[model samples]
Target: MPMRPPFFALSATLVLLLSIPAQACTLWAAAGPDAGGGTLLSKNRDWAPDHVQILKYERPFGGHVFFGLYAEGNNDPGIKNGINEKGLSIVSASASSIPKKMRAHQPGKRGVIRTILSRYASVDELAADADRVFSGARANFYLVSDRSKVLLAEVGLDGKFSYRVVDKGVQTHTNHYLDPKLAEFNVSIGQSSSTRQARINELLTQSPRPFTTEKFAAISRDRNDGPDNSLWRNGKQHTVASWIVHSPASGPQKLRVVLANPDQPEALHEYTLDEAFWKKN
Candidate 1:
């Protein structure tokens, strides 16, 4: 059942992070025996609709192609969640509160994904030089996936980033730091969810036989399933966008993507990896 660990890793991570107001974006990734043995990633972006758009670009060096969910007219590491031609998908969730220490005395305060995408091609490449790459960087959170593996990269304000392979079964994270050491600086109210993460965890652990995109959608679209929380919240904390990306077993260009905006049916905007890369500007 382990198909889309990294994809759904974005799913779980995003779901748990996008908690309240414009202060959150949830992400999740699931693989191993529970993900239908395929890599699936999903995200729920909660923000002002006017600021979000799906963007595409040609790699500077390789000139292959890549795409990401980003703010309009933004390319300076503008991707909130996106995938590259190598089937590398990256999604990031902002912290409601970053410890003051994580900030570096560098130029760009936060642009980690774009920096990696601009230089290397895969999560392995980024991981190899994580220390050197993230030097003079601020705190950042992301779920990035390559062809064969998924990773949860947490860069704390202390100027250190940790990457963990979520290819095991399933993994989820929110804006709040889960590391006991990092939690010391976490002043978030409830970004760390017990009910929401638990529901996703249970579904990933004990769902029926084969896991399908529909099943994942159902869980994501579930409004009342959370005993202590809800995925599709209302008021200033409602969903701004929801999307799913699945990498094929053969190649990375033909990534399958389905996206919905404001939690409603999709309006047919460009999202598929191949189509996005082909997009003009």
Candidate 2:
């Protein structure tokens, strides 16, 4: 008979396996020349309570860039966030607790994100599709823009997607839903919403100028008051936090992107992607 493995070794193996960290969500910020002089600011996180993986799908649509994000089963070239060849940008965020009355009124469909991108060439165009696209799914917030315009779109859990056009100003968003109509369901109370919001405001206040890709990257990597050296989460504070800024793509063809770990300020990663690089296959 084969000899049995030692008890201590087996115990150690189990402990090691248990010690591995889980795959936490990731946040990213992207800004650059918009095929024109307009600026863009976008912030998004990839989250999962299940084995779902959120991805960006890029393709040519109507001679422009089209992209979207959808659940694994609903993959039909949908886009959660993307910028087209014409420089229009779009993105979405989670918003919980939609009204049942609203939920009952939506039309079911696949690839809603892609549908919005393919049909709408501007923020206004995308806003028009909000209610129809948001029906059936949980609440979600959106940021859509082109070289000359910007809009904040909110889709309630009840399938009501509303638009708040922001023509000229800076905007910031996190995980919570922001709509006066759905304010009763806003669950940000007692959460880290205040803390994270404060931090984002602080960073933006520190850097007030014409938005640039470098400035946008710097905002994304800011982890000033994080409890741990790790930028992933503030365990003591009980919250997962991250930030990003967007600007109209203009000026130099090259732009910088940076990622920083709060625990190790000295170890920062930076990337410079130019128009040519962004256009690569």
TM-score of each: 0.73, 0.60
Alpha carbon deviation, residue 242, candidate 2 (Å): 8.8
What TM-score quantifies how close candidate 2 is to the native fold? Answer: 0.60
Candidate 2 residue-wise lDDT, 1-281, digit = tens? 68545323445444444232222222222223221245555452333222232334366445554433344432212344555544456666544232223223445523345555666677766657556665644555666666556777656543555666656555655545556776644532223343444566666666655556555555655566464222334443212222232344454223222222234332322222336534655
Please report, in order, the local distance difference test score of every candidate based on alpha carbons: 0.57, 0.45
Residue 146 lDDT, candidate 2, scale 0-100: 66
Give each model's clash number: 43, 23
Best by lDDT: 1
lDDT of 2: 0.45
lDDT (10s digit) by residue, model 1, range 91-171: 777654542222324355557666666566776776787777655456756777665567777666546566677564556
What does the lDDT read for residue 89 in candidate 2?
Answer: 60
Superposed Cα RMSD, model 2 = 13.2
Residue 93 displacement (Å), model 1: 0.9
